[model samples]
Target chain A: MENNLCIAGFGGQGVMTFGKLLATAVCDNTDYNVTFFPSYGAEQRGGTANCYLIISDREIGTPMSDILDDLVVLNQPSYDKFVSKLKMGGRLFVNSSIVKPTSDRSDIQIISVPATDIVVGMGNIKVLNIFMLGVYIGYTEIVPSESIWKSIMEKMAGKPSLVELNKNAFEQGIELGRSQK
Target chain B: MAKVLMKGCEAIAEAAVRAGCRFFAGYPITPQNEIPEYFSKRMPEVGGAFVQGESEVASVNMVYGAAAGGTRAMTSSSSPGISLKSEGISYAAAARIPMVYVNVCRGGPGVGVIQPAQTDYLQATKASGNGGFRMRVFAPATVQEAVNMTYKAFDYADMDRNPVLILSDGVVGTMMEPVELPPMKSDDEIERIKESKKKISCIGHPLGERVWIKPGVWDTIMWENINKDAEKLYESWADQAEWESFMTDDAEVIVTGYGIAGRIARSAVEIARGQGLKVGLIRPKTVYPFPYKAYEMIDYSKVKAILDVEMSIPALFLEDVKAAVKERCPISTYLRSGGNLVSREEMVSRIKKLASR
Candidate 1:
């Protein structure tokens, strides 16, 4: 009984990597089967880096999610383009620091958080991916926060020191999530 | 379950899918592009793998790689793109890994026109690659036969442990007709090969040290030396190629062609028969076999000529037909190329003219 998530942002916003990390985390750690598809290269450059994820108890053949339960937009263009595509009652989380004038929908729960500002204060601007990943977990526990940390370690399986910095960034993201709500 | 309207190229792809070919790798090449496009989305829906490769070389190599991993993998291409894959095709033959390659032939000798031509007949039967190995070559005259025979290509490839080519022309590939696809291989036949990767070629020893080796130089040499009996390799592909014969029991003139040319030749023979000409078609479903026995069994007393028609420039199959029926009858060529298909009326007129001369 997992959910479908769409994470979108500008070219270098780490949206594709974040989606892949979540997919790998779910597939490797959780019981929920997962599928992930990313837009890359020619068709994707300068437009938006979007990824569709399908997480369910059964086999998810098509990775593309026609219906989205959670949508996270990291830029104004991404927010403007994908806001109306979310399923009814779905949660919409906006990085208000970069994404301005977010959509106003009465039936959907909207979180306006300065995700990048929190990561910038943590002294590592690269931790923005983790900060948004934390918001994703807070809205819907599709994958455990612990698995995301494991995923960071797994991703840097060949690197040692980077793992330490990512673990710290992950903790800082959790702290930001706690202080915001 | 019954006849379905499908393009000839699409029928070939559908048959390969029904044959339990779970993996397909190919790039877009006209005259044969539909083969991959038809199966790209369809194969994945049924838990199969489909990859649109960067190029024909990469595509065939992907097939070779996946097939060596114990999955039934296939690829399709036309003349120009197929030329790039000859290296891999030879490698597949040398490895005897059983891969299906479909060549929807276009007019060739260069970047030939994207029109139906049996120009690759020599390239297919004889080694276009740098080797002495032969691939099992098939030529289906009709769309329905193309669908039925495509699965046979996979089976023969696997059973003989050799590469098999379904050589069709542009007309054969692009033409649409009613094709009733048979369940190529039983579900169990392929199910047996599902876990085949686990033992069929995987290395042995402690789990940690056992590297995932495919059908490579080590295994091929090891098996070759293990079963050094030449008869084993000979027996492997003895029954691989075959064909079809109609009214050749007592007739003299044998009209030889394959794919679209063969289809046109069939109607030509019928029209010639209506004019009291004793002409009959020798359509080869598997051109590699050449039906030498059928030609040898021809009643030479009544038969005076063998008219060989093809889309290539007197380039292929004509010589093979000559050798098969050298002492039996005189063989002549009615060849055409560069994007033109032989019509039925023209074939009949040619047969009639040849008979009179």
Candidate 2:
């Protein structure tokens, strides 16, 4: 089984980093094969930045897919650009605090998480990706929670205290997502 | 050991380190800037030297110098940057310097775009530099292959006392995937490798003996000798030509490509086969040697046609395919340029159309 995902947001929203973390976690912690393909160049100039990731049980031939099984967006433009490309019945996770997805697609599952509000409670917007990932795992359970926690800690290895904040942010997201489910 | 997921750029740099590359010199270019960025931090950690040359010319010459002194030296660049280094690359060939250079190719007759394109096939395999020099060029299809090819490139260079080129495109250079990294070589091993070159190395030798030619005097004999030796080395590389044949045994139509395009074609061929099409793939892992023998081994009686797919307009790689097939079958091309990828669906459709004809 191949799981294709496109995580997109404005620059500095940790979109690429989130995909990298997921790819790395799957590669290092599980038996799955993974590929992370980032979209570089002009779009990265303070504009919409994105990356494509594939986690598969078998060897992955292509790093990208035309239609993504999961579309994670943090802003409105990203939502507008990617919502139609999501596979029917695919999972859509949006940061509802900043992005209000106006797509009238009832075919897919949409989980609007108020990530900005939650990160605001933590007084840091950078942990927004960790919170979103927490919500992603809460719904999908692609990998276990401890695996993601370890991956996050390893990624933030040098910055010890920020790990604590990110962990807390992730826990809050997981709790919110569980209640919604 | 646990596997790691790494971008192609970082994996190559780390592979260079593992392969005992002690000196790296390069300028920054899109889709390949990560090589220098990783080397700048990594080389020093391993007690190696790293130079961010002001330009591609300076960078290649720096690598040439390091290779001459018996260090496993490498330089990486995109298309235009590689064009700038052509002169130094020629000098390295003339001097029989063993070095590795990576061309993370981008679309270009000129600096076209930063996205992946294989337009440098002719530039890399046919005429990398003046004086008719040839280097073994390995085109990797996957990230794991990229790592393996890069890790072994230094050895190939050292064995032949010539340059080895890893001709990757933007896709293979920037994409991230899981790879089982090679074991790192120790400092003692590096020193031993360097020490073996003390007899002929220019580092501590007399200026008269080490220089290729006298400063102001023309030396026709010296030029002939260098060319003759390079000619012999180039001919010896025929034994090392490598190719991959994917289900070509009983296939009627053979699809041929190199690098990432080849990988795409293999997948397309497999999918077409599931639909009962007799399509197969011949992918050249080593493009400079061109693997003509592999093409010649095809059963001409059963094969109906040959399809050459690449990410270049005018299809530079097709010339080699044509030469190998010798007009035994109708040859068709599926090509794209200006940083556009050669899509698998397009390849499958083209192969199917050719098969029907």
Candidate 3:
């Protein structure tokens, strides 16, 4: 019962990687069958990348999502590209560091966070993706926070020193979102 | 298992491997090249064998050699490449060797485009080989069907000691879909399959203990004896002939095609019906043992005309449908070629336009 999550951004924003981590964490920590698919257009290199995630108690018949339950829009172009397509009652977690506030919609949930700015304030620019991921976990509570954090550690276990910094950034992102709520 | 999304040619290759097929030889051609590519990678993983021959001609002959070696063997190519393999296909039939051939069809009677087409129907079903040898042809409309038929083709080939072709089209080949793979059969169960006219499996002989017969002797009494024995072997393809029927009982028109064309026709029929058109689709799953009987009992009076949609210009398959439904039902054709796919919208509109006529 997590969600059909989609992440879309520019070529190197780790848009696909964020989806992978979310899918992996949900599959490992929850009682769900999950699929993570990264699809791109004709360009093989330096083009946009989008990831499709379906985590459900039931089997996922198709590995793609036509209507997203959750969307992580990383840039102005991505937010503009996918904003209208978000399902009513779905959440659009915007990187407020880039995109400006638009018209308010009654049917949807909008969480505005300067995800990248927070991570940069924490003295590391590369951990913005982790910061954004931490926000999704905080709002949804779909999977246990401890498990997602553990998955991040396992994923980055190869680089031991970076783990503590990412965990701190993730915690800060969660705390910042909670403070606003 | 369950169905999964897969490429058409790769599905057939995977199914053949699952069926205990151990040898594959092929040269690559678009639309169907992934079959060889699939086996080239996956066959080794399963401890089977794969070899890319010098040409389509060479590949078919290698399949023959492997089949002659008593291994379940297969090769895939498009229309032009199949022409190159004709001599070997004919030889395999004449010599009565059991194997599978996958023809992922494209447009034209010659070097056509790289999209899906059903233009190769006549060459595949009627006769592309010498001495009028007939092969059992299986045409699948979906990727999973292609996979299942590839396995069935091997069994059918071995049963009849003849070639069984799984004729697929470009759309099915290129589209990726979800599919569940069948479990691998046990080695003992594989060995338990009765070898049919296997001239390759010679026991109790090692190193130079065997007698090497000259090539001339193989053509003479030895060849005749092999064929004679093959004639006595059980044919595996005889009984499996079927077609899928959808709402044809009160159908005023029967829309017919096979493989990708058939899939398109199915969607067209559904739309045509929603618009109050009493049209039904007759998808021929097999081309050789074509379901002539399925059309025989149709309410011909209601079925005033039959629209035959195809990826090739009118010929072969259209001709077959005409012959099958000739006396009672009038036939019409809508065609696109050079590997272009005719849309369902176009077909339904065409049927409506012709309905008054």
- Cα error of candidate 1 at position B318, Å: 0.8
Residue B90 lDDT (model 2): 80
Error of 3 at B236 (Å): 10
Better of 2 and 3 by TM-score: 2
Q: What's the candidate order when arranged by decreasing lDDT?
A: 2, 3, 1
TM-score of 3: 0.67
The TM-scores, chain A only, for the candidates as listed are 0.88, 0.95, 0.90
Order the candidate numbers by DockQ, best to worst.
Answer: 2, 3, 1
Ranked candidates (TM-score, high to low): 2, 3, 1
- Residue pairs in candidate 2 whose N, alpha carbon or C atoms collide under 3 angstroms: none
lDDT of 1: 0.74
- The digit string of per-residue lDDT tens for model 2 on A64-103 reads 6666899999998899999998999999999999998798
Tell me each candidate's TM-score: 0.62, 0.93, 0.67
Worst 10 residues of 3 chain B by lDDT: B210-219
* Candidate 2 lDDT tens digits, B141-228: 8889999999999988888878889999999999999899999999898888777766646656666666332111267886677677
| TM-score for chain A, prediction 3 | 0.90
TM-score of chain A of 2: 0.95
Worst 10 residues of 2 chain B by lDDT: B209-218
Better of 1 and 3 by TM-score: 3
